[model samples]
Target: MKQINIFSIIAAFIGLPVLFSSCEDVLDKKPLDLIAEDDVWMDASLAQANIYGMYENLNYFSHWNGDPITYRSGGEGYYGWDYYNSYNSDCQADLYWGHWLSGRGKDDTGWTPSTDFGWDAFSLIRKTNIAINHLTSEESRNSIGVSVANDMLGQVYLLKAAFYFMQARKYGGWVIVDEVLDDIGAVAGSDESAAQKLKLPRATLQETYDYTIDLCEKAANLLNTDAPSGQINKGSAYALLSEIALHGAAYLSYYDGINVDAYYQKVIKSVEELDALKKYSLVSGAEEYKNMFSDYAYAQTCPENILVSQMNESYGYRDAPYSHINRLLVNFGTALLNNNINQSFQSLDKGYSMTNAGAQIQPDPQMVEKAYYVIDLDRKARRFEESQLFAENIDIVMEEDRWVPGAMREKRKLKPTSSYTSISDLMYSRRDQRLAGTFVYDGSEFLGNTIYFRTGGNIHRDSYVDKAREMGSMTGILYSKRVPQYREIVGNLNCTNPIFRLGRCYLNVAEAYLSLSTPNEAKAKEYINKTRVQHGGLPALTTETGGELKMIYLDERVAELNMENDRYLTLLRTALSWGVTDPTTGYPTGEKGGIIPELNRGNNPTKKLEIEVPGDYMVEEDFMKPNAYFYREIQVPQSDHNFIFTPKKRYLLPVPQSELIENENLWQNKNWE
Candidate 1:
C-alpha cells in the first residue's frame, strides 16, 4: 500500500464520494447490479475504490437523519403522507410506511417482509452486509486485503448500526444482523427444528447499543486515524461513537429504564477530540453568515460538519428533495394570470385530483414573523412586518418558532450575500443572518417569467402580472415566501445540497460545555468559553453578559446555527428538554371538529368562500413553555387539524421488513405491532 498523502483527503473529498454516483442514490427506481466481492478487494487500489462506493452510499438523502413532519408552507393548509392525497397512502393507521401515512402513525407493528418500504429497508441492510462479509472473507485476507477488509467491515457495521438507529427511533427497537446470512440457505432448511430455528424474535435495545459501539471501535482501529475525511476518517468513527453513545444513553435512561451518565461522558469525550481537529467554526455576522449557505459553499463542508452528502446537480441524480426541479419547478399548482379585466382567479388545477394538486410549500406567517424577530430584532433593521395573523409575535420571544416550510427554501441563485441588507430598518431589524440567505424581501432584484400554474412553460411572473391586468392585483402575499425573488438561471447552477455540515460541531461543543457547567462549573466554563473564542462569537466571562457558560452557549448556538441546522435533532439527541410552544391561535382539535366546516368548492363571484379563522386564535404571550414531546423541535403542518394532533412513536421510521425476513439470525424489535 502507498503512504497516505494530502491528495488522499482530496481524493476522498472529490473522487471517492462520487464513485457510486448513479448506482447508490437510494431513490433510484432502477437499481444497480452490484459487483461480486470476489472480483474486487483482492488488490489495494480496487479495495480503495470499493470503499469510496460505500461512502457514496452513505451520502444518499435517504441515508441521513430525517424530520418527522412535512410543512404546508403558506400555513393555509395541511396534509402529507397519511391522508395527504398529494402524496400517496392507504389512510390506514395500521400501515407505518407510506407517502401520506406518516412515520407519525401508530398501530400494529412488526411489518411483513413484502411491504414496499420494508423492502427498501431490507435492501439497504442486505447491501451493507454483502459489503461487510465480503471484506471479511478468505479472498480478502491477503496482505493487501487485511487493512482494506477491516476498514470495509467497520464501515458496513457503522452503516448497519446507523440504519438500525433510524429503525429503533421509529419502531422502538428493530431487527439487526452482523454476518451476511444467506436467504436461500435459511429458507432451504427442511427439518422442522431447522425451520423453527430460522425464525427470529426481537432483540433488546441494550444488545443493539453494545453491537454499534463495538463496530465503531473496530472501524476506528482499522481505518487509520489520520486519514482524510470523505472516506470514513477517524472523525467519522468519533461521530458514530458520539451519536451511538448519546443514543444509548437516551434509550437506557428514557426507554429501557436506566440512567447512564457514563454514556453521556463517553459522547462528550469523543466529541472533544473532533473539536480539537481545528477544521471548523461557526461563521459570525450576517454577510459571511448568509454566504456560508449559498452556491459559494459548494465542495465545502463547514468546519463543524462530521460527514457531508454532496449533490450531483444531475437531474434525478441527487436526493429528491434537493433537486433543481423541486426548487424551480414551474407553478404547476394554480393559475396566477388571465387576460380578463378584473383580477380573476384563473383556475388551473394541473392534471390531478386533491392528491396530485400543486402546492407551494411556502413559509407560514408564523415562521416569517419569528425569523423577522430573530434576524431583524436580534441582528439588524426591520425589513418585513409581521402579517396580521402573526402580528403578536413581534415582542414575544417565547413563541414556538414554526417548523420551516421546506419548499420556500432559497435557490441561492446568483444573488449577493448582502442582499438581505435592510432598507426599511423597522422591518428587517433584529434577526438571524440565515434569514437573508433564505428569503427575498421586496428590495431584491428578482427575475421572473415564472410559470404560473394556469399557464404552461416559458412564462414569467412579471410578464403575467404586468401584461395580464386582471392578475396584476395579486402580489407577494399570493405566493408569500414561496416565490422569493429568484436570481440565478434556475436550471444551470451546480448547487450541491448540504446533507451534513461541520458548523454544528461548534454548536455541539458549545452545548456539551454548557451542560457540563452545572456540575463541573470551572471545567465547563473553560470548554464553553474556548468554543466561543474559536468561533469569534460574543466573548464569554463578560460582566454584562452574565458570563454563565450554559446561557452564553445556548444563545450563541441559536445565533450562529439557526434554521438550516436541525435544532430538533441536536436537542433530542442531547436529551435536553427545550422548545417553545405558543397558543396565539388555538389548534383545531376534535372538539372543534365540524365547527370550522369543510372546505367549499366554487368559482362564484358574489358567493365568496373565504378562509375562516378560529374564534379563540388571537391571544398573545411573551414566552411559551416548552412541551415534553417536543424536546428540541418537532415540525408540524400548518393546518388546524395538525395543531390538535400529537406526534410520537411513529415519529421514527422502522427497519424495513425485508432484511428481517431474509436474515434468519436477525430478530425483529419489539412493539412495532
Candidate 2:
C-alpha cells in the first residue's frame, strides 16, 4: 500500500489521522477545498481517496506494533488486535515460557471484553461504514461510473465483513454498528438518547455470522474475480466465506445443537469457486516453496497467495521495515549463511546478517515431533542411538563434506573447502524436501558455509540450551520459512505475508468433507492429494477414521501453516467440535480442552554431559572407557515461568475493564470477572 497527499483533503474535514494512502498503482488529483458533501459524490477520484484510506487502515503487520514473532504480555497492546498475536507461531512457547500469564489484563486479576480485538474493530468499522454510506448514497451513482462505484463499494463491504468476522470469532456476539457515526459532536454531546443509542448490547452469534456472510456475498457480487493481490476480489471473498462457513458449521454442530451439513457443503462450494478463478495455485519445488516465504518479489506473484499484507519497500519513501523473523530463529554469535568459524578475528566478514538471537522462538518439541511425523523422517538414530546421532559418519560421509546427495558432480568439479563432516548431513539428506526447506537443519550448505546448531557447536549458546532443557532436549530443528539467505542485502524484509493460500483451501475442503456424517473419504483424499501426494511426495492417506483421520488432517495443518497465524484458530475450532461444554465453575464456561492441552502435556527431557579421561593420564585399557561427568542442573521454576494455564480461564480473553466500567449493560464474559 502507498501513501498519497489526499489525506490533506480528508483529514481537514473529518479530523482523522492522515496515516493511510492508496494500495493501487495510480493516483489522481481533484481540488480539495471546493469538495463539499454534494460535490464530493460527483468526483469519483475523491470518493476513491476515502476508500483508499480504508485499504490503508486495514490491519496488516506493518500497521500493528509489537514483534509478530512474540506476544506482548501487557495484554493486546493499544490496538487490541491480539487474536493473531496470541495465535501466531511466536506464541507457541507460551505453554512453556509462560508469556500469557494474565488473561487479557495487565495482571491475572482484571480483564474485560472491550479491550479485546472485538472492541478494537470499531475504529476500522466506523471508517468503513462511512465509506459504505458515502459510496452507496443516492447521488453516488450519478457522481461515479456505476461499474467503478460498485467495485469500490464491493471493497468496502469486503473489508467490513472481515472486521465483523474477526470480532465475531474473538468476542462471540457483539453489537453491530453498521451506520456511520460521522458526527462526533452529535454522538458525544449532552443528548441522553444519542448516548443511549450507542450503548447497545451484544448480538447473537448467528446474527453476527449472517451479517458477515451477507457482506461477503455482496462483495462477491460486486467485485471482479481477477482483482490485484492487494485488493479484495471475489476469490478472496469466497475464501473468507469458506473459512467463516466452516466455523459457523462447527459452532452450530456442537454448541448450538444444530446439524450443519449445509455449512460444510457451503465450504466445499466456496473453495470450488476460488479454484474456478484459476488465478492462484501452490508454488511447486522445494527451493521455490521456501523462497515463496523469503523472497518478497516471488511471493507477490506466487499463485498460492490469495490475500496478502504487502510492505511497500525498504530504504525508499514508503519502505517499511522487514519482519525480523530471522533474528527469532538463529542464536547470537551464530554465523548465518554457513560461516561457522568459532573465533572472529578482525576483517573476517561472514557475509551474512547476524542477529541478537535473544528473541529466538524455537519450535515446540511436540511441533517438531509432528513435523517429523508428517514427512516420515526416520528418527531411529535420535530415539535410541545417542552416540551415533551426533558423531561424524566418516565412512559414509562424502569427501570434502559434500553432505547433500546428488551433488557429486559439483563435488568433483570444485575443490574442497574447510568444511567438516557430521551425521546431521546424512540425516537431512534422507528427510522430505519440504522439511529441509522449512527448517534450519543440523547440517546444510546455506549459501556456501555448512550451518550447524547443535550443542557445543561453534555457535554461541544462550537460552537455546535452557529451551532445550525445557523441551526435554533440543531436536536441532528451528524455523527457517521467512529467514532469508541474503537478508543483509535483500533491500527489504517486506515479503508480503501470505494471508490466504489455495493449499489451505484444499486442506479445508478435505476436512469439511471428512466432517460430514457419511464422511466423503474419497473426496477428502482427492483434495488432500492435490497438495500432500502431488506436491509433498508423501504416500496417500488410505483408510483412517475417527480421531486418527482428524489427527492426520491437523498434522497436515501444522506442516503447512505453522507460523502463518492459523494454528490458534485451528485449535479453538477443533476444541469446539470436541463437544466442550460450559463448566460449572471454571472460566471456560463454554469451551473444550483441545489440542493445546495435548501439545503442552508432559515434562521436557534433560541431558547429561559425558567426559573422557585424557589419553596421557589414562591407562591404555582405561582410555577406551567413558566416564560420566556432570549434567546441567534443572532451573528452579520462577513464578512467572511456572504458569499453568487453566483451559476454561485462558481460552477466551476477557473484555477490557474500561468497557465494563463505562457500559453498565455490558458485563464480562463468564468467569473473567
Candidate 3:
C-alpha cells in the first residue's frame, strides 16, 4: 500500500502553516501583522524578499548557533554543513585521512544506509515552487510590473533547478514536484484523498536531467545579464547549467534515450554563452589567485567569481555561535592536508618534482645547519621585537596596596612560538607558490604566527602514538586553502565561499572537450592551460594523447581545486567514466560509481621527519627528549590498515530510511535494501 508523501511528511515536521487563508479574512490583519499572501505578490520588494529566503540554503557553512538552514540540524557541533565535505574527503580523497584507527575512515563498518545524505533540500524547492506560482500569475505580473515579476521568476527557477541538481547528482532520479500541495491533513474538495494527490512517483534519470536543463534555460532567458553581488544572473544560470550537463555526460550510459555527446556539447555551449558575456576571467598571479579565495572584499569585485555565497562576521554569532572555516580547520581539526597533495604542485623550473623518491634522499648536513641557523635567528629577532613592543605599550598602575601593577595594556598579543627549525622547509622551498598559499607546514607564517606541525611543536603536532592522539594534523600539514589568513580570531573569518567561478568553468569546458567522441586534445589543452599558466605560475601543457591529457587535467584540477571539495566529486566521476558498474543491477553507475576497490581505503603514507635539536631548545611536553630529534614522512604501520573494505553500495548514499518508511513510492538506491 502507498504511504505518506515525503514532502507532506517534511511539511508536517517543519510546521509549515497554511500559506493561504480565506479571501474574506485577508483584510482583517493590522498593518504590523504578517503580510497576506495576496499582498506579497502585489509589492515587488515583498516578492523579492520571498525569493531571498531561499538563498539562505545556499551557504555551505553551518550558522554560528547551529542554524538548520544549510546542513544537518543539531547544534553547531559535528553536523554543520562542512561535515559532509570533510566526511567525504576523509574517506575517499587522497588529500586527507580521517584517522582510520578511530573508525572514521572508509573501512568503518558503522557507516550505513541510515546515514543522512544532507542534500535533502526539498524544502527550498517547495518555497521556490510557491514563489514561482505567485510570480508567474497574471495578477502578480500586472501588480508588481512585468519586468519585476520576470526577474523574480528567473531567480525562483534557478533556485528550483539548483535544489534538484544537488539531489540528482547524489541520488540520480527524484520525485518531481513543481506545484505546492496542501498540508497532509488538509481538507480536500475532490473524492481523491490528499495522500493520493501528494504521492508522486520518481521520474527517470533522463527525465530529471531534462527537466532541470529546461529550468536552467528558462532562468537564463528571464534573468538579467548583470546582477548585484550575491544575486543570481544569466551567468550564474549558465554556469550551473554547464556543471549539471557535465555530470549528465559523465553518467551517460546510465540514462536511457540520451546522447552522451549531446550532453558534452551542452556543457561547451553553456560555458561558451557565459564566456560571450565577457564578464569573467581567471585571476592572474599567485597572490591574486590566493586573494580571490581568502579575501571577502576582493572576491566581491573579482571577475573570477561568477557566483559566491556572501559571508560576514555577524554570521558567526547567533543563538549558539557557529564555527567558520578557520575554526573548523584549526580549532576542531576536522581536516588536514594529506601530505600526498604536495606532489601535485610543480617546482619553479617545472622540471624538478617533489616525489617520494626525492623525499627519501636526506638533505646535506651543511644545508640543514644553515636552515636551522636562519630559523633560530628569525625566531629570536621576532621574539625580541615582540617583547620591546609589549614593553612600550603597557601602562603600570597602582593597586589598593603599595605601588602594585594593575592590568597591563598591549596593542597586540603575540602568538606562542609554535615552530622549531626543521629540514622540511628546504624541501618545500622553490616549489609552487600555491603550496605556501594553500597549506600551513612547519615554520610557515600565518596571521603573525609561526605555525608548527612538527612532532613536539607548541601550537600543533603530528600524533603517531595513541597517548598523543589529540586534535591535530595527523598528516603533518594543515589545509589553508581558501582559509582567511588575516583573521586574528579563529571563528571571526569573513571569507566568501565561492560556489562557481571562471576557473572551474574553464576546467569544465576542457574536460568536455577531452570527453567528446572525437577527443579534441588540442582544445582541451588550450582550455586547461589558461588556469595552469595563469594561476599555477607554471608553463603551459604540451601536446599529449587524449588519455595522457586527461591524466594531466586531473592533476591540474587537483592542484587548483584540492581542498575546495572537488577531489571527491572528480574521483566519483572518474570512476563512472571507467565503466564501473552498479553493485546490484550490474549497470554503469555513471557519476555514482565507486573508486577502484583496491584503492578505496586511506592508504597514503603519512609524512614524518626526524631532526637533531639545534641549541638549548626545550620541548614543552614531558613526553619528548631534550636531546636531538626531527620529524619526517613515514608509512603508517600495517596494523593500522586493518579496515574492512567499503561496500560498493556506498557509492551513492541511500535515500534516507525515514523517507523510505514514510513514502513507499520512494525506493532505496540499488544494493541499499
Q: Of the candidates shown, which would achieve the greatest lDDT relative to the real structure?
A: 3
What is the TM-score of each predicted model, taking all chains together?
A: 0.58, 0.72, 0.70
Kindly list the per-residue Cα lDDT of model 3 for residues 45-97, writing each as its tens digit. 66665565556443431121111322232344344433432333322444443
Q: Where is model 1 more than 4 Å wrong at Cα?
A: 1-36, 45-51, 60-120, 137-147, 184-198, 225-230, 284-292, 296-298, 301-305, 316-325, 328-359, 368-424, 444-487, 491-493, 509-648, 651-673
Best by TM-score: 2
* Candidates 1 and 3, the one with greater lDDT: 3
User: Which should have the higher lDDT, number 1 or number 2?
Assistant: 2
Candidate 1 local Cα displacement, residue 607, angstroms: 24
The TM-score obtained by model 1 is: 0.58
Q: TM-score winner between 1 and 3, please give it.
A: 3
Question: What is the lDDT of every predicted structure here?
Answer: 0.38, 0.51, 0.54
* Superposition TM-score, candidate 2 onto the true structure: 0.72
Clashes of each: 51, 14, 15
lDDT string, candidate 1, 1-673, tens digits: 0111222333544634433434222223222234444655566665566545444434322211133122122222232321122111111211011111222211223323233332134445655766665577686667465765676676666666666654454454555554333432242344445534434455677776776677776666666554444555666666667666755665565556565666667667767776565544555544444444443242354544445544433333223433222322224223443343122222333231111212222222233342233322332222234332123232222323232444232111111222322222323344444445444432222233222211111122332433321222111212211222234333333343343444544344444433332434455455544534443332344332223333344444433443332433443333322111212321122221121111110111111011111121111110011111111211222121121112222223334466566656554434233
Full ranking by lDDT: 3, 2, 1
TM-score of model 3 vs. true structure: 0.70
